[model samples]
Target chain A: MSFPGLPRMTGWRPIATILILAGAVAATARFAFGLGATTNLSDAFPWGLWIGFDFLGIGLAASGFTIVAAVNLFHAKEYEPIVRPAILTAFIGYLLVVLVLIIDLGRPDHFWHPMVMWNPKSVMCEISWCLMLYTTVLSLEFAPIILEKFNIHAPIKWIHAISLPLMIFGVLLSTLHQSSFGSLYLIVPNRLHALWYTPLLPVLFFVSCIASGISMVILESLILSRGGRDYLPTPLRANLAKIIAVTLAVYTVVRLQDLLARGALRELTTLTYYSLAFYAELLIGFVIPFALLLVERIRTSRRGLYAASLMVVVGFAFNRMNTAITGLEQYPTQTYFPSLIEVFIMLGITAVGFSAFSFIVKHFPIFEGAAVAPGLHHTAVAAQANPGFLSPDGGDLEPS
Target chain B: MSQKKAMLIDVTLCVGCNACQGACKEENQLPPSDEKYLSLTAFTALSKYNDLYIRRMCQHCDVPTCVSVCPVGALTKMEAGPVAYDGEKCIGCRYCLQACPFHVPKYEWSSTQPRIQKCKFCASRLAQGRPPACAEACPTGATKFGDRDGLLAEAAGRISAEPTKFVPRIYGRDDVGGTSMLYISPVPFEQLGFDARLGKTPLPMLTMSALSKVPNVLSVGGVMLGGIWWITNRRSEVQAFEATEKKNRPSRHEDNP
Candidate 1:
């Protein structure tokens, strides 16, 4: 009953299993019945929890492009240890978004409509193309890791030949869509409240995702470190913290400047539901994380880094949720909370993601840089010719 | 692309009758429901502010934001004046529902095969040389249908004819780049729940301003990345080549000895 790739049905892993089962059932009921029966979405609020989750997932998964661009494109080879995990996370993150999209779509069957039907004018169209194309590039980037396990060298070499271009294209696609998520709301300037809506939303979104993306990488390393191994060295994690701190600082400055310029500062001074939510989001997502990371002691400490990254991720979610839901709540005059079915379905998809990540990591060379294939998994001896990429930064990548 | 028809809804003349709502439901073949606000079943709904009854329907902007934001081109601005919805083409991402400034588009969330439901300006009847069903059904002539230019002029004429009786502004004349539906009210349009601050520029222009920069990003970004990759990798290649040459070169001390 055991498979090499599947997680053992023990510990908290079983909860994920149960969730996966429940989520699949809920998904079936959703498609079988309708969004109204499953979700609290109405004419007043067409997008709800799922759309917010899409932003969160995409933002957090930003590590894949950022890391690859640094190592493969800029030749920053010192940070190659977490490359496989970052790529895998991005792959899972995107697929999860697509899954939620299918469940969220009124016509799951017509999800392909965007593929054949082109509307270049629409930001959504551009986002759809980028999502698909970037996923392909990620596959190429991560293919060698799996191919080496199976001892398949030909495609690995082919993939390596075009690796630089592939990584560049992936980064470009990521930049477009990550910002386009914010652009999606630009049309709703009237509908979205003054507190959240701004002409600089795209820039804000793009910058914030970089912070969250790096935080995600840091958080992943810390979380897995509990299993008795430092997923990333302290120096490396601190280096990443420095990046997050700088990104958050830029985000804070831009946001403040924009708010001041628009004369929306008065709205913040007034006590209202929206102002409170905005305050909370800024505090959790930006202010707190920025200040915490500024402390050299906290930045280098495992506990401090953990708290900071966790705050960044939470804050990232808060900002996106507030932007997507809370800010738009006033115009609609109707409150929306996801139904039990909706909540379960979202949880299940998340569980499935975790399960899939564990499964792939167990079988593939994700965390470890080894190309070992014990027992029957080893297919051929292409070790010398295998497209194992060395440091792109040359010798400057050595433990500095 | 054709005649460019428009509807002028004079709120002052409206008598709080729900006949237009009824007529819209009947024409679209939606289930009969006297909904208080816009819904899947009611394409046109009436909201009362004291004695004034306001009609809510698709503003059908000339540069419809919904049309511009639809990834599948499901919501389209027709050749005539109506903004049409093609259900078969709809992936039902609900971008139209989210983007509409008027909040006119409603979804069939209760149906498995949900499509956006909105007022289509009775496009079929317009093809048959008739006004929209709502315009035709209005008992007090509150809703008038005609060529867009003609309606603007007539609305202008009415405002000046009895400036004291009207707000003296056509609500949709310049708002959001001129919606197909025009409005003239006794009081301020905001009092009637109209978003007067939607700006004179079309909403699509906001997104387009960002999207327009995509080409520049690609070309400039591509060249810069390629150049960096070359320079960085070339330095590494040169360093490794020099290292090998140092190892292979004959020793000067051995030659002297």
Candidate 2:
């Protein structure tokens, strides 16, 4: 009755199972009783954690296009090793975003209305189309892996034939949508805090997502190496860190310049909650990471990369939250905080994503030279690849 | 039919009475609540700033940002005057709630199938050639209904005739690109809880500047990417051909023999 790629039932499995069950229950309640009963969302604050996390998920997934452009379009063959994993991450990230949207949407059943019913004037309509199209592109980009697993050489060739065009389209779509996320806020200049509101927000969002993407890739690679999976070469890792540092530096300059030009820097002088939030986002997310990654020794070192990348990710999350939630806290009488059910639902989604990623890595040819033989389940491959695999030290026994 | 209707609310004449509230509730058939802000049941609410009582509702702007941002065309500004809502068309994405500078649109959070709730400017009453329920119920001539241009002229006259008794500006004449609901206050409009910071430009114009460049980006980006693809792929193909040719050739000793 066990699934082919399912991991062994372990201590944490029970916890994940509990979270999934709890999430299902919460979803039922939300659907049955409506948003008022299950969520903290109100008339004043319509969007909350779901929208904010959608921004974060989309931002972190930016590496898919970045890596694809580097390897396929720019002819950076050295980056070929990370391409599959990056695409995989993006595919999962986008799927999770859709899931979050469905949960957050008041009419989840009518999610597809935007496809047939067009509103080109609205930035959200543009976002919906981009998300749909880019997801298709990601699927096309990732199709070769599955074809290779099945030993379907003909379709694999077809996939390779269309890959270049697909990557180009993907890059184009990602560029539009990533920037358009910021464009969504442009209409709310009066509501959004002056510290974050500017005409240059779209450009800032595009650049910051690039920095976040590079940092996320670095962080993921480090985690894989520590888990005894296929690790990226030190040279490639160093190169990525350098890219992160450069993008972060550029982002910092543009952001500060925009603030100064808009006279929004004055808002930062006051020690209010919003100003404090702004400083924390800037100093921790941009300045510290930029400084850390600039040093060769730190950028190359394991601890340094982990620390800097983690900071960038945290900062990116904070930025999205600030834009979507904290900045809109204009009325003192009305405030929003996600309910317990909402929190658990988010956790459940994250758990599912993490488990799915682990399962796919174990099953698929995500890592270099890790292809499984045709007609064999991934569990069989894993057992043959490493005997005595039940022990705690089994992962360590695998070749690095 | 030739003239667009408008509401001119003279705050100087308002006495903070609940008649408008009672009338609105009865006309809308909404449940009773003491909510301080607009909600699903309360299409309009009154907020007090010191002795001044201001009625908060949809401004129904000349260039309504909500109608522009509603991906489903659920909200629209009718030519007659009111900004109308079609519940059948609403997917409830709530972009209207966010895009509204006045923060007027309220959600039906309690309903399984929720719709955005706001003042539609009494489209039904207008169709019947009658004033809105609130305007009809007003004991004082505070809330008046008439042609938009005529109302503007009247508002202008009142402000000029008693400059010392009124603020120098018509609140909605140019705020957020001019709303259909006009206001004239004795003290400053800001003191009556109006957002003085709202710019004169229509909010949708801000997003339009960025969205308009989408076509150019797609075409230019497509060409640039195609060029890179061709150049890079061609070089790799040539290198591969050279490598295969090298392998096919005999070794030096074999060739000499």
Candidate 3:
């Protein structure tokens, strides 16, 4: 299976290969045996670990829109080098989320039912439409990279012509879908813990995803930089980290204000599973990472930057899981823990995502991307991505 | 559709017989079993609360949370006062199961092609102007079937007639925008495990508060983003043009020399 220049399947690749295979086996068992036999899901707890994984994956993958909006739409030319890599990360991340969603759905066969059935009032309905559209937008957003690599200039020019409206639509779709994930929880007020429930959920979710998406981009930069060149400069990485700090600060203020207004501040002090989990989520995901990133020295250093970004990513995962599972645990019913099959299937999906990303990066021109491509060609590809931004900063980044 | 049908179950008039549960199983075509809890097999169940047997089933909410949350419109609130489910339309996301405040909707977890199982308030029977199986087999007139307004009047009459026998509040009358199934118990409702704090407004409204804003967000957000893109790029373009002009002015003099 080894290509001539590609690294041989060795080290972590074998483990990933096995995980993917195991996941396929688990998924097959799940469909054949039914949810009851192969999974711990019950009538009382319909949504379990997979739903939490979807939230984390989508939130992290938000780098797709964030980076595109930054370089193409917002006229941030200095950050252009890492744009292709960030978009690829987001593209793969969303594909995994959609895959897990299919497996988690009881009727995966009827997944397209949302397309035919219209329910404008339903949050899930809106999310489904947005997810499908954004994924298409992301692929179109990513199309030029593949096209440029293959020297398919005709479609590249055509894709370029529509790129401005594409970016706008991409951002709009991501904004709606990401926030709607929080809206899904609004109807469950009686069941969801007070500490997690609030009308500000949509806003909180949108802001936090921006922070996490940036963190993911930074982390990818660091990972790619290892034993090679730094994909992004230290100052650039630090600048992005500063944005994370600002987003986190805003998230903290809004969340605390909402909790206080709901009189759920008391629940924070009363020691229990819900309170303890909420504290951990707040501390790890928001407070610690925010505090660390605020320090100028920490934001600039490789180790400090890596640690803070990783914490933000981990903390974000914890918060989503706490909201999905821990917050709903105290309601009158049996507590849920994902079955082994469930765990393996999730691990499998993750393994496939990593394997696919590395394989694409190895074969493609993601890093040595538009920055070095023929100046006129890339200027047309990237500069015109946002209309007004195009003729100004967009042309200067290229050698005219 | 005509005045919306309702069931008023007065606990004071009933024994703890489980006849309603048995009748419900037969009517829904579920397998015969003395299941003590609600499941795919049991649409309704009798759970003991001290000496009183509290009946549990779908309340068939007027604006059901399950119907509002379903992505595929698999669930619908019928005009005749039943919350209905069409398994074919369901993608089986299980969002309905998560959103139901009463936890009434059950999933057929044992089936390869599972569907949500719950009381549809016997929609077909109500459509035929016949009482639901459970209400018809109540034996003691404990479960009275009539129009919602008629049920409300009967419940108020029972409460006033024997003040000591029934609680003044009808469990479904104004809770979560009123349910087709109403309960009038001798004891306070909360003591028997009713979610008394569901509030006066329908549960779907809570979701709508966020979902309804989507259109405004989409339109305004689109226009605002487009404006920002144009303005920011224009500023950069001006800055870049100025820098190039300064460099070329010095070069022009050197060329003449």
Predicted structure with the largest DockQ when compared to the true one = 3
The CAPRI classification for model 3 reads as medium
lDDT of 2 by residue, B1-257 (tens): 44788899999888878677778888998886655678777778888888888888889899999988988777888988799998877777888988899988988888899888888788999998999998999999889999988999999999999999998889888888888899999899878788778889999999999999899889999999889977876565555545444553455436568
Ten-residue region with minimum lDDT total, candidate 3 chain A: A372-381
- Candidate 3 reference-contact recovery: 0.79
Second chain TM-score for model 3: 0.96
Candidate 1 CAPRI assessment class: medium
lDDT of candidate 3 over A169-231, digit per residue (tens): 889999998998998899988988898988888888999999999999998888667735776
How good is model 2 by TM-score? Answer: 0.90
- Give one digit per residue, the lDDT tens place, for model 3 in B1-257: 46799899887777878788889989988888887888888988887778777788899988888888888898998888998999999888999899988998888888889899898798999889899999999988888899999999889988999898777888998898889889999899998888877897998898888888888888998898888888877676566556655665677778678
Instruction: Quote the lDDT for A47 in model 1.
Output: 95
Question: Please, what are the lDDT tens digits per residue for candidate 1 over residues A187-265?
Answer: 9988888888998898999999999999999988887766666657898889899999999999999998899999998
What Cα-based lDDT does every candidate model obtain?
Answer: 0.85, 0.83, 0.85
lDDT of model 3 at position A93: 92
Give the poorly placed runs of model 2, Cα more than 4 Å off: A1-12, A152-158, A331-334, A370-400, B32-36, B241-257
Query: Chain A only: TM-score of every candidate?
Result: 0.90, 0.88, 0.91
What's the candidate order when arranged by decreasing DockQ? Answer: 3, 1, 2
- Evaluation by DockQ, superior candidate among 2 and 3: 3
> All candidates: CA RMSD in angstroms?
5.2, 8.5, 3.7
